[model samples]
Each structure stands twice: as C-alpha cells, then as structure tokens.
Target: MRFKIGIIFIFLCQIAQAQQSEMTVNQNHYDSEFKANSELISEFENNGKSNAEFRLIAKSNDNGKISVYIQNNTSDTISLSHQDYSIYILQEAMNKNGLWKPIEYWESSDCGNSFGEIKIEPNEIIQTKSTKYSGNFKTKIRFKLSENNKVYYSNSIVGNINPNKLILPNDFSFTWPLAIMENIGKKTPLELQKKVVFLEPNGMEEFNEFFEKSMNKKN
Candidate 1:
C-alpha cells in the first residue's frame, strides 16, 4: 500500500509539470504574433484595355483606425469614376471557445465630396480615408463595381486573423468580363473563349469537365 501511494504522487507531479509547460508554450506563441483583436480587408481592380492592375489593401492600426491603399500598376492615363467605386470593411471577434463572430461593418463613398469623380493619371496611385461610414468589424468583406448604377463586377475576400498571420481561407475570384459582355450583346464570340476558370469549392478537374460540356452544349 505504501509503494502504491508513492507512485501515485509521483505521477501527479509529472502531469502538473507537463501542463505548466504547455501553457508556457501557448503564451509564447500568442505574445509573438497575436494582435489586440483587429483585422482588415480590402479590394480594387483596373478597367483598362491593356494589362492595368489596381489593388486595395487595408490595415488595422493600434489606435483603432483603418488605413486604405489604392495602388495603380500601369504607366498610362487611368480614369477612375468615384461614383462607380466603394470600399467596405468588416470587424470580427473571437469568443472564449475561439470561434469568430461578427462585430460590425464600415463603408466609404465620395469622401464627403472632397474626392469625387476622381481621375488618376498613369502610374499614379491614391490613398484616401473612408469618411462616409464607420462601424465595428463584421465577418466578411465585399467590394463592388458598377457602371451607370448597374453592377459590372464584384469580388469577395474572406479570412480570419490568427496570431500574427492573416490566413486567407480561399483563392480570390473575379467575374469574367466576357460573361458580362455576352449578357449585353457586346459581340463576345463564345467559340473564341474556350476555357473558363471556376473558383468554386469544386476541384479543377470538375471545373474543366463542366466547361467542356457547357461549350459542347452551346455549340
């Protein structure tokens, strides 16, 4: 009986030590990478004949301010229609069980008329604040584009903040302009466009098969 009691005490000591070590490791990981409960999301695009590109990046500062970047990637004149553009941000929080929950949303448009119908010449990028809307972060970020009040393109970006890394949950996808043109009778030759890249959850092999069948059916 004495031997068994001694062995049980030793085993309990070992378990306690292991638990302490695990807690230390978790704390160290959090200290190195985790931000104080904040996240950002943004999107942008270029509408030019050539390979023009635009990007919108968002960052959450320590003081609860969100900064936005509108970057242009071409050396030619680029005209931006502010009426056709908008920016949105969503904030989220983690619960005690580590599940992410939506907190709020923010949006901006026109910049109080101080910026309107803006035009950025080739190679010029603009950075501005979204003064039109402000709220807490929500669960998703959506960017939309339109012409004459009709939506021409839209994209959705989803991610969650983990320690010091922003893990992108999936690949970003853009609607093909050819599909839009076809809807408007813009002379889009369906036969010339042979491949369609579907960014859905389905695998690439399935997407390719579907594309082939759709084209065959149309023909």
Candidate 2:
C-alpha cells in the first residue's frame, strides 16, 4: 500500500508540473505580444497620418451596395494604395453595448501584387468603391478604411445584412490592433500587419479613444 501511494503521488506531481509549464508558456506568449503591440502603437502615433480635414462618407445607394467617398479637403494629394480600393475595408458594427466590432467584408489572400496607388488630387471628392453588406445582423454599421498607411472611418448607417455572420460575441471588444489583425489575411497592408496585436477583450474604450485622439473628423 505504501509503494502504490508513492507512485500515485509522483504521477500527480508530474501532471501538476506539466500544467504549470503550459501555463508559463502561454503567459510568456501574451507578454511578448503585449510588448510588441506597445512598440507598434508608439510607432503609429509618431508616423501615422492625421489629416483632420479629410472626410470619409458612406451612404446607401439606390442599389444594394454602400457607396464610399473620400473628400480630400487637404491641400496635398492623397495616395491610397493596396489596389482593391474598397473591398478590404472592415465593416464595423455597433453592439447593443455601444461597443464596436468588425465584420469582415472581403476574404482573399493578401500576398498579392496590388501595391498600386490611386491618387486623389487636392480638393477632389473621389468615389473609392462600393461594398455589399450581405449579412443578417441589423445594427449601426460603418466602414473603416486603412489606405496609404493612414486610417479613416466613415459615417454610420444601418446594417441589417451580415452574410458571413462574422459578428463577434457580445462580450468581445474592439482595439485598433485587434481590428487590424483580424483583417490581416484579407489584403491589409504589410506594414500594418507586422504591427498588429491579437484581439483584446476589453479594449473598446481604448480603441475609440485612440481614434478620437488621432483623427477628430466630424461625420
């Protein structure tokens, strides 16, 4: 009986040690990611474009698609790259809690040769492209565009169609890094992809704060 108890105790000890090791590895992964995200956020704050005069607007056309337009109120020409102009922009939904979450609009490989630029001359109001929202989610939805290494958001419109059902859980939240990472596989810029962080559970407030601070454009 004494020998059997000794073996059981050793087995338990091994199991405990293994679990502890796994947890340590997970924690280390999270720590590394957090540190990397901090660095990326700092870099973006220093270099990301902040043209308050630029206006991004979205309106439902007579057709089923939403037409997006970029009004260049800036004095300089704006160059928007990543070729499929409007396809990869994120379709964001406002949850019941008033927090925003992204519902992906396009699904395609980003490893393409779509590095071409589309220039909008000064004082030009150009139509970038249109997106068809085919989902069943009815909420206040908006478009988030990352073009020319700068981020711009559109005015909110009602969204009742969410085809892919890509909506996040009610408890889920939004962060710029998380939103950018979710769209990384879908033709997002390589520079932004390299700086993305995993989805944060409660970063909605922080995300809005960052947007407000960086681009305070009125809709």
Candidate 3:
C-alpha cells in the first residue's frame, strides 16, 4: 500500500510540474511582448537621441480598438518630436501543405489613415487608437521621428490580433537566415549571432519561402 501511495504522489507531482511549465511559457511570452512595446515607445520618446527612458502600455478594447499608452517614467518631461506615427499588423499564414508560412504584413496607412503623435508629460500617459487588421496576428507599432524618416524607432507587441479567435501558436521553430541567405549576402557578426539565437536550424527552408512570398506582395 505504501509503494502504491508513493507512485500516486509521484504522478501528481509530475502533473503539477507540467502545469507549472506551461504557465511559465505563457507568462514569458506576455513579458516578451510587453518589453518589445516598451522598447519601441522609448525609442519614439527619445527619438534615438535622448537618454531618457519611456514605456508602452497596450490594451485591447471590446470594440476592436487597441489603445496604446505612452508614458514617461523619468522625472523630466519627454517630447515625441514626430508629427505622425504608424502601426503595422502582421498576420501568420499557413501554406496549402499544412506548413506554417511567413507572416503577412499589413500597414495601417495602407487603409487610408494614420495615427497622430502626442506629447507625453512626465509621470503622464498618452493614449492613441490602433487600426484594425485581419486575422490572428501580432502588432508592430513604430514611431517615426520627423527629422529623418529612415531613422525611425520601432517596437513590436506580440499577441493575437483576433481576440475572438483561438490563440496562435507561439513556437520559435522557424529559421529566417536559411530562407534569406541570398538577401543577406554580407551579414555582420552581430547579425549572424542574432540569427543563431532566433532561428531553428532545420526550419530555414520554410522561413525563406514564407519571407519571399510576404515581401513580394504590396500589403
């Protein structure tokens, strides 16, 4: 009877451990998305020029509008010197053969509108409405500095775009380098290191194919 009880306890412990692991994964994904958004907001506030730090807070409304909040954490006021900002929504796609393809990029400006910029005071938050895009996808918000369009600071919030639909898979099994090796002819060592950390070794072909398709389109 003691041996049977021990086995039961072990099985329960295993189940608890598995549950904890799944929870940790979910929390990590949430934290990653939050951090990405925060980084983008900081870039916009500082315009890649100021040393002050900022953060982003993204909240989804029931009416399908995403409200992005920009806050200044420092004691001094931070100014976002941009006239207009833009938000891009990327949808995940699957090929006919049941393989996960590259992300489909859609811009809010393409829909004939854009988000305006606002000044964020110290210890204050400014909110802006986000444009809607189709499918279960992630949000990448960018704030462009008025001085030079090419030197824009960007941040991506990783979450499901379609709140009504099922959650999208968050597996990092795809390798982007193999798919775009021809495009990245002379990559820097730092770029190579980032690729190694982000992409899976065996999924290069799949990553490249999806990237090619996505880039070729106007959306």
The numbered model that scores best in TM-score is: 2
Q: Identify the runs in model 2 with alpha carbons over 4 angstroms from their true place.
A: 1-53, 85-88, 105-112, 134-136, 163-219
Q: List the residue pairs that clash in candidate 2.
A: 134-163, 135-161, 135-162, 135-163, 136-162
- All candidates' lDDT scores? 0.34, 0.48, 0.38
> Model 1: how far is 205 from its true place, Å?
36
**Model 2, 45: alpha-carbon shift in Å?**
28
Worst 10 residues of 2 by lDDT: 23-32
Clash count, candidate 2:
5
Candidate 1: worst 10 consecutive residues by lDDT?
Answer: 23-32
For model 2, how does the per-residue alpha-carbon lDDT over 15-122 read when each residue is reduced to its tens digit?
755432221101100011112235433433454465564566676767666666555557998765433333235556676688866554223224456435656677
Clashing pairs in 3: 179-208
Estimate TM-scores for all models: 0.28, 0.49, 0.30
Model 1 clashing residue pairs (backbone)? 33-164, 76-122, 90-137, 90-138, 91-137, 91-138, 104-136, 104-137
Which candidate number has the best lDDT?
2
- Candidate 3 worst ten-residue window by lDDT: 23-32
Model 2 residue 181 CA deviation in Å? 15
